[model samples]
Target: MQRAKFAVTLFATVMAIGLTGCGEEKKPEAPKPEAAASTPPPAATVEIKIGTVGPLTGSIAHLGKDNENGVVLAIEQANAAKITIDGKPAHFTLISEDDQADPKVGTTVAQKLVDDKVAGVVGHLNSGVTIPASAIYHQAGIPMITGSATNPQLTEQGFDNIFRVVGRDDQQGPAIASYLAATEKPKVVAVIDDSTAYGEGLADQVAKTLKSEGVKVLAREKGTDKTTDWKAVLTKIKGEKPNAVFFGGMDATGGPLMKQARELGIKAVFAFGDGACTDKMHELAGEAAEGLLCSQAGIPPQAASKAFLEAYKAKFNTDPILYAPFTYDAANLLIQAMKEANSADPKKYLPFLQKIDYSGATGKIEFDAKGDRKDAEITIFVMKNGKVEPIAVVKSGKTIPFDEFMKSMGGA
Candidate 1:
């Protein structure tokens, strides 16, 4: 009986082992490498191009670079933030083009940007270029913002796609004229323009305003944009002995004019518009820059945000130039529009961008129906000890002292 029980127990144990093996066989197996490969990867990121066109290879290339750098800095910040447009991860691709400050070249560049399908454009620093370029961009339905081009007709042309970050020449022209009448008290102010659309238009406005203020305009001389020889102009102006001389042109031309004016014994206070109010003037004019007064389109650098200054310095290894602040605002304005409209297409976001009231480093940035910046403040800088220093600010044609301007910015 003991032997029989042992055999039965051994048989049952074997059966139990066979049943457990069958149960293990029914379980699911792991997937193979080939099967795993069938799963799709995450969606690829999308790209949107932002065209930057300016005079990247001309006499005022420094100003162009400053404008370009501002846009680049804004793009870098957007990329760092991992910007998403239209529900997809979007990257901003810069399509930079140089027009050599030529209006015809500007039109070609604008068409190229249109053909390249750039979503937006920031550039053509000179008014001569911006005015003609506007039609090209408008035809293609591309929105463009000018940071430096201040010609009023640029906005007055009725182009819905055009915008300007800086104040118009009319605003700046009248403000400077008022300051000159009230403070400079010039008996006769000579006016010289480079004969380009920008230089001529601005000089005309300044002359009109000065004449309106009962200040006599001594000479409305003409100078080509590339003229380095101011011998005749200076000789004529010196003979007149005007109390002040206003230059409506860029730093490249303005610098030589300043140097030559001093060299020719023209001992009058030199005044300049936004086009000539660049930091490059310091180096270009050398010691002749002393006591020179110039007008810029926005608030003084002293009131710029510390964060902006620090970031700009860290990125470019230099301080902001005349129009960089406005350029920064222009770039950010478009990006903010893209964010709000939830689209990267210029046609979709342009209306949003137009209506945007962005408070940038410049000031409260609101656009008029004509695409001009509203409530624009013109900052007047004086060359003191080899640097341009803000002495006063004018808003809506009212001159405010430097101290008072700072206080107003504080909301006091």
Candidate 2:
């Protein structure tokens, strides 16, 4: 009886242990929290470098700085907008180099920009500098658009990468010459040049146009770009006593030339090309600048888009001196082409740039087969009341008064 009772007890204990094990196995796991939905990581940001080259420290440094400021404003606006390319956020950087308006220095700085791996370039304000520096950019397959360089030779080189937002010297020359012939009706006109590529090339065009118009053109006069003392040259020109004189040089030299001409009693109607068309001329020549005539390769800064002018003034605390509007357009051209291509690579975006019809601060901008701005306008300005005021605009072979042109531009 005792052995049987012990067996029952052992059996009952084993059964209890088995039941406990089954209960543990059947127990439900604590409810798991729901998983959060998966999300993809944000796209990486990209850095794009755009270069601007110009005379940042010399006689025309003001103009160069203006060009640089244009690019800076464009880049800043693009960043503020949080632009994207190929699904990646794009950040633009401006790489500015000072060419000092010197061709040799221009080439050197151009190579430096190439080595810096800039996607594109915006200048080298002087044609003399732009032409040589262009070869460097072409060799590296980089695109360069000049905001102010207007020498025909720049576009005549047949480099697909070369472009300018301003009218060529050839175009500007004829426009100003025609206006001079019509307004002044001078019997004899004297042509003078600063002997740089831009100055000499423009003077040649002027002389050619004047000859075509049956105006008596005296022999071309020459001086270095640095020639501030014009007493000797003016003495020679004064002896000729031409009824009208055209000076193809920057305001720096042209201002002094005009001031000295007035002092020397040379009472000729002084006309200048885009180089000397600036408010600075008045400052440089003082009261002598009044009544002087000048031509600009593009519309005056006052004619730029209200947005651009306001932005420029807000940033720079002054109006654009010259070429800033074009440089601003040039920089936007690059950025727009990059966006269209979805890539910042020059090789990828260049074709878009070649065919782009960009409506920018200046106006509608389009490049022809030769990479020159199509239907570029040449503006005539007169120094009145201590300011350079646009008097007329020459566009598509038609000269329109400044007021009418402004109306046509929707009063921009």
Give the range where candidate 2 is weakest over 10 consecutive residues by summed lDDT.
30-39
Tens-digit lDDT track of model 1 for 218-325: 858989999999889999989988999988899999999999999998889888887788778889989998888888776755565556667899998999875777
lDDT by candidate, in order shown: 0.83, 0.89
Tens-digit per-residue lDDT, 1-412, candidate 2: 9999999999999999999988676432211110011112333767688999999998889999999999999988887777889888787877889999999999999999999899999998998899999999999999999998987899898899999999987798889998899888999999999999788888998899889989999988899999988999889989988999999989999999999999999999999997899899999989988999989888877778878988999998999987899999999999999999999999999999999989999889999999999999999999998898899998876788998887666554
Tell me the spans in candidate 1 whose CA falls farther than 4 Å from its real position. 1-41, 44-46, 184-292, 298-303, 385-388, 403-412
Return the clash pairs for model 1, or none.
none
Best by TM-score: 2
- Give RMSD to native, each candidate: 17.6, 18.7
Model 1 quality (TM-score): 0.69
Q: How far is candidate 1 from the true structure (C-alpha RMSD, Å)?
A: 17.6
> Model 2, which residues run further than 4 Å from truth?
1-41, 58-60, 100-105, 184-204, 210-268, 275-290, 385-388, 407-412
**Candidate 1 worst ten-residue window by lDDT:** 27-36
